[model samples]
Target: MGEIAGGIATAGVAVWLIALSACDIRSRRLPNTLTLPGAAVILVVAAGTGHGLAAVAGAAALFGVYLTVHLIAPAALGAGDVKLALGLGALTGVYGADVWVLAALGASLTTGVLALCRRLRGVRSTVPHGPSMCLAAGLVVGLSATV
Candidate 1:
């Protein structure tokens, strides 16, 4: 039963991420409607599972790190990226730190590659980050399964 519930939750998250990616790509903005509720759901589920404090802390930490980066290099990242990280962090907190790290690494690497490809093509680096967020979410799910 737990496994089934987890699978359903994972699938739901994936669908949510895909929608967010589409919106971000089309409009360059992530709607609060998607991110806020998603974070709330993760927090509620994590708390119900006895991982409340850790999950909250992880989410805050993720936000804080991103906030710092945003402050330091505002041009390198966007507000949507920070919000996306918060959602991913909350989900990762439900799994574990390892999954969180894997997700972050996956997102960063994917973004870097895309940026490089765009640069090589002599195109301006205006890559939307939603796809990277989706990749991170997928990586988190895969890593959680391994654990």
Candidate 2:
């Protein structure tokens, strides 16, 4: 991808991710409104731009990872999250499998630290994972585009 195209793609995906994060933060639910359309947009762009097959593999790979956890503890992980992961996996997958690994590891570290903090504070309420996911997505896309 050229400089302008990569920048534009990253920007578009970032916007989507940020909007979804806001919704998730507010409602603790990732409505299909944003995520479904967002996934379509990412996959379409990725396919048209020559990242098609990798994007599919990426989405499947990440979806499976989350599915495993979801199966283990359905209550702890919501379906919305798994759906969001599918979209995000496709997004990160455009770059490569390594990008998905980076995003997952980075997001996991962020979530773990925040969750630990909340536990220490005696705040038992569930923390929304979407924001961390978005943060990781943004970081991966931005970093990959630059490199």
Name the lDDT value of residue 88 in candidate 1.
Answer: 76
For model 1, how does the per-residue alpha-carbon lDDT over 1-147 read when each residue is reduced to its tens digit? 299997897788888888888988889888889888888888888888898887787788778877788889887778878887777788776677877777767777888899899999999958877678677867777666776
Error of 1 at 68 (Å): 1.0
Global lDDT of each candidate:
0.79, 0.85
Instruction: Give the Å shift of residue 12 in candidate 2.
Output: 1.8
Using alpha carbons, what is the TM-score of model 1? 0.89
RMSD of each: 1.7, 1.5
lDDT of 2 by residue, 1-147 (tens): 788986787678878888888988898888988878888888888899888888888888888988898899987777788888888999889888788899988887888888999999999887788788889978997889679
